[model samples]
Target: MRPILSALLLVVAAGAVAQPVAPGQRLDGIAAVVGEQVVLYSEVDALVQQTTQGREAPPDLWSRALDRLVDQRIVIARARQDTTLNVTDDIVSQRVDQQVAQLAAQVGGEPQLVQAYGRSIDEIKVSVREDVRDELLLQQYQGRRMREVKVTPGEVRDWFDRIPESERPEVPELVRVAHIVKIPASDEAGEARVRAFAETLRDSILAEQATIEDLANRYSDDPGNTNRDGTQNGGLYTTLRLTDLEPRFQAAAAAAEPGDISPVFETPFGYHVLRVNSRDGNRISFNHILLQVEVGEDEAEAARETLSVLRDSIQAGTPFEAIARRHSEEPQSAARGGYVSVPQTRQRDLSAEGLGPQWRATIDTLEVGEISEPAPVTLADAEGTQAFHIVLLQKRTPAHPLSVTDDYALLSQYALQEKQNEVLQEWVDDLRETVYVDIRAEQYQPPAGG
Candidate 1:
């Protein structure tokens, strides 16, 4: 059987439910009530419309959508009562801001978003905050409960045994690889120049030679300081939580009192000189000037040379993993001996077709146990920074029928999912007994004991 509770359905992009139309403009009414929560007819209709996307609705589609919504309401209602599952106000506000920002970006800007939504950005934020909170609560509860469900080795073997030989699936061509990435190191001279420039800007602000805003508008390298319409923000960030800042930047900003000009500090992006404009409890407003160190041809070539040396070391039988652990610049992968897995998943073997063109092309030419020459590859860094790396193709498995011996991980995943589904169903069944669920819509039946 399928899982009882599906992933929460977010309506109208990031839980920004459509506003009610003017009175008599359209028909709307409550579809059901789960404890104190009311489910709107329009909510169910909107989900059905989104899922169908102009295609013909299958039988019982509306009822199925309502069931999903009811399940969410029941879960959220119960989760809210659990003190351990409490979602904090700060977290909710942060999520609300993030969703609004995303929505504004998708619509071109805050102004465009206001025009489309028929309300101010602040009003829109208020309207969506509760919905975002509910979604987060549902997610938190699901994660907590699902983490308790696990599958054993015997369960995995049994799941594989139940599948007939003729019905077994094919495993795609997968490769396991490790890499030693070297980002171009900044030259001391270039870094010193940036530091000097940052210090000079800070001094100018302190001595009243120039205002920080003016200098930031003129020289700050942070793109966030610029607006979409060619206007500069003067490096002003308002109502920012320390948690939203880069760790190093947060430390520097936290040390300064309101109206203090901080000493020049360095983060991965580069040097910064911060001026705390104001502070209110945990919220702060600040203006800053940033100077990014430029990476020139010499720096790039030096990184390539370093990777070349590491490649030679690995070829000379000085274990690839040992060299990677000591020198790989990407912290997370370096900790795992430079083993790069599929993002967000624990699987080490990756499908060649899913890899980026650069990685796929480079790995295609190398035999198992062969290390490729140092070559330029894009780092997964936020800035898409260019870097050099030497890749070792550790294992390459060609397409074959899935087998218990060769595909245990994949089988284990299937077994775990099945177990989690059954557990979730039991949890939902228990909730139905305790929660008061009333369905008033025609042609829909109230669940037993609900």
Candidate 2:
């Protein structure tokens, strides 16, 4: 049975739900019937396009799409009957605004977004509001389902005891790890060069050596306002508070008197030089340029050396968890004493898989309670942020059957999951019986009683 609590609804697009038919294009039709609601072929097509991106369609993709739509319709229909799932327009508007902001960031600016989508921001909102409403309804229903689920200790132990020893599954070998992470400091020389660049831009604007429009167009990485004629409106930020600007940029702008160029300042995005054009109370209008810098390797070796010293302290009997909580930069595992969870998580099933191949090889040789020397690993993000980690392998466990003695805690969790899944399945089966689901497509139809 499919998971009933999953939130996998399609994110609606900026245009009409159905795509406009091109010349010689085939007309779309209804794909399924879910009670009073008709599932459109176009709706399924949009979702399939979103998930698959530009890739070739997977086998039974249509069936999977139909199944999701049916599940959503079932949940939504039931939700409308319940008075507890009330969601106001304001709440959905906030969600819409956040989604739009994300899209703006993704595309760089509002003007570029409008050009790309061929729709104004208001038009995009009207298209997405229906989707947001249905999603919020389903969220409330899932919350109610979770609140009604209860598990007891006796239920956990009884479930574990009934599983035959020979038939129990073997878990993969696993390691628990804690880590301290640090990024190298930005290069001082490069930073100075950037500051100088910002100052030059600021000086040019101040002396009227170059117009704000010219300097902003030539130098600023900040997205400039665009006109229909495709000309930028330049570095001017109208009606913004000093606080609205980034801290480093704000401080510089606040210090400078109106009509003077502020001292160049640095921010994560780049170096900035602000010229306050006017001030009214706390709000100000200003123009600025951003000069991006690159800094990943600077001071990296120093950070590694610091972590190595920390590991030595742990080796000398300092409690790993306490040290991690106090000093470790990897927040998730440090709070739990540096333990990285293994996949074999049931009672007696403590295991980890696919640590970097090199890390795994070394971890295989270490026993429980032993610590592996800091192995160097580089992590880079989508924004080109690069950092190094000094990892501590805190604990190791072998694959084994359910153990009443060592794995009681894990067994309790395992039992709880099993109980929840079983309860949720029964709920879904009941929902299916109440719904008027008709799968018109042959391959997409559900089996009887399924």
Candidate 3:
């Protein structure tokens, strides 16, 4: 979700709910009242503190937050009257769990989180659960209210054209490449050594010689698991995105089942023995012990020699993609003929520049058929470890301003959002009229322009 919308939702949902005063506490005064719900000064104060936490906020942030809260409460009261927008308990519970886990991770862990908030985990869970439910309910109500919003093609084109040339979207150079990979096998003795080590650890766990937490702390290669006492955080399993994890680890993880322990598997970095702790849908939680395969001077020379030979083969008319698929140890990109899709074009598009930087730089330096110099890159494993990669740039594109013909999808989204916002505002206005809202005279000042 967009950050602006998320903040707006948080303000609305939290503002509408009454904060419980401690038994011995005295109330200063009411801030506002919407229908039967009264907003307290303390509530407004809490919102101000939350909004300003870790950063400086605008001078009128409290007033702005209060206004947003009023708009939200009005809409929420009307939503309750509609009776068609009931958010389920299960959905609320899941959202609550996700938020709680995120909050816990952000604060280091549950114990630290409890200390910071002065609330037990269970208490925090209950509060966060209600907050999630309220937020979800408001979102559902807003979505249903704006269901008929539509943006025409003409509108999209108009918006595209209205964007000033200086402000127009720029398309960066992008490359498309593919490759095949082959990971070198560990020597027989090395494989046997790792297998024996895993068996011993398993036996120890079975015999109560050591706990899973102990083994994970001492030997698990995944740092994420180590922090959680060898447990998967939040009971959520990791999703196998090639970008987020090593290709070999992703492949092995994707294939394993809950409670399945994999035999020693070799990848470019080292040999790993993985144990799948749990699986929920496509998410899999796993523990692993990684043994670094010693690459002595001779071994390093040999591997470099092999890569040089592979590079030569590509130059000698063997397709880079074919060679990558056939011999590259980088499983993630090799299987796709070494093509790494432009990050900005992906669905979520979490790229740092929002699809503007990385590809643009590469496009400037690379050509369609030429390969780039071998560059060192780090590939993260399922447990989040740095595995090295010798990345070759095989493709590139030039930067150009966006056009309607070439950027229709992006323009269409902008058009759709514009239409939705207009409809949502009208809906909110209608709800405000229906809901009985009474703001304290001092707190009811309109915006400066208004």
Candidate 4:
């Protein structure tokens, strides 16, 4: 029984059918009463304007919306009967705040948000929170309803057969790739020197001798934390999730409380010390300074020589996966037999963009199952730090029609959703009979019929 849903029940049937009138011209009246909830004509007019943004709508829009509102009220009432489903006001408030923060960022921050939205930050939050709560409740009900639905292969095939042959999907060229990557690290002496510098900065911040930001400006090698003024941030990052952070960073963040400094830690990006500014739920906002170890020409040459030996071994007899596991510096792919994979569910095509000029050229020349000549490439790693790696290409595919052999997962997902939608529709229909739904019959009349 949200205010927005209750208000839209009463539009003049004749005027709406002929064409839309300006908002001021609409008369308010009750369209239906559901249990204790009432629907109003002006609300319908406002909703049509809100939904279509004042564009022309079909004459029966108000009636159709009224029917939908009645159905929604039924589902909502049913959800209320099941006492275990609980969404708190604070959770709704947080969601609304997060949404507003995102909008504020898009419009050049909060001052501009007021300009674009014609409302203050607090005003917008107050208005949207109830609507957000309603959405969350509906989502919870539907999510619980569909949780155990699992579609089978036979069902997927049946779904595909129903589509016309001319309308079945064609797939893009898909490629499977494997690689070996190596990064240069300074000799032990150079690494020790960098680690010592990071330790010194941590001590300095602790003693209040100098700020983490000042130290970052002088020494942090990461390219991602630069300000608009071209000065480096002391790695001040906000709204970060610990799980999304690198293991070393996550551990450091978790071990410290707000206003406490984390012990120095090592990540591929560099050695670092973090100062926690705030913690909210599972997210943290923090400042830190990194001191990256600089590897010299000797280190780079040693890395290249090592990769050359690895390439020669793969050609001679050794399996690529075994050699990559022993030596590949690209941590993620190295563990997975050197394979470069798209998220199996997200994409089927791996476009050739940004693989570096060397990788792009090597991939283009290779046939399926052919290995590329060992090549030098620079990789921008997860922390936005750069390292040089030697690479290999393993497989490529040409464009082809989608089939059970190549696209089972995608087809199964589509069939599953269709089944879920049908189940949800039936659930809604069942709810209609049990609820006290009063659609005002006299309000919607047929034109003089033959």
Best by lDDT: 1
Q: What is the lDDT of residue 406 in candidate 3?
A: 63
> What would the C-alpha RMSD of candidate 2 be, to one decimal place?
13.5
Which of candidates 2 and 3 is the stronger one according to TM-score? Answer: 2
Clash counts for all predictions = 0, 6, 18, 6
lDDT of 4: 0.66
For candidate 2, write residues 332-403 as lDDT tens digits.
556666555542342222345555555566566666666655555444223334455555655566766657
TM-score of each: 0.54, 0.54, 0.48, 0.46
Candidate 4 lands at a TM-score of 0.46
Error of 3 at 385 (Å): 9.6
**405-440: candidate 4 lDDT, tens digit per residue:** 777876887788788777776777887787777777
Off by over 4 Å in 1: 1-28, 45-58, 102-116, 177-346, 354-360, 369-394, 443-450
Task: Give all candidates' CA lDDT scores.
Answer: 0.77, 0.63, 0.57, 0.66
The ten-residue window of minimal lDDT in model 2 covers 1-10
Give the Å error, residue 366, model 3: 4.2
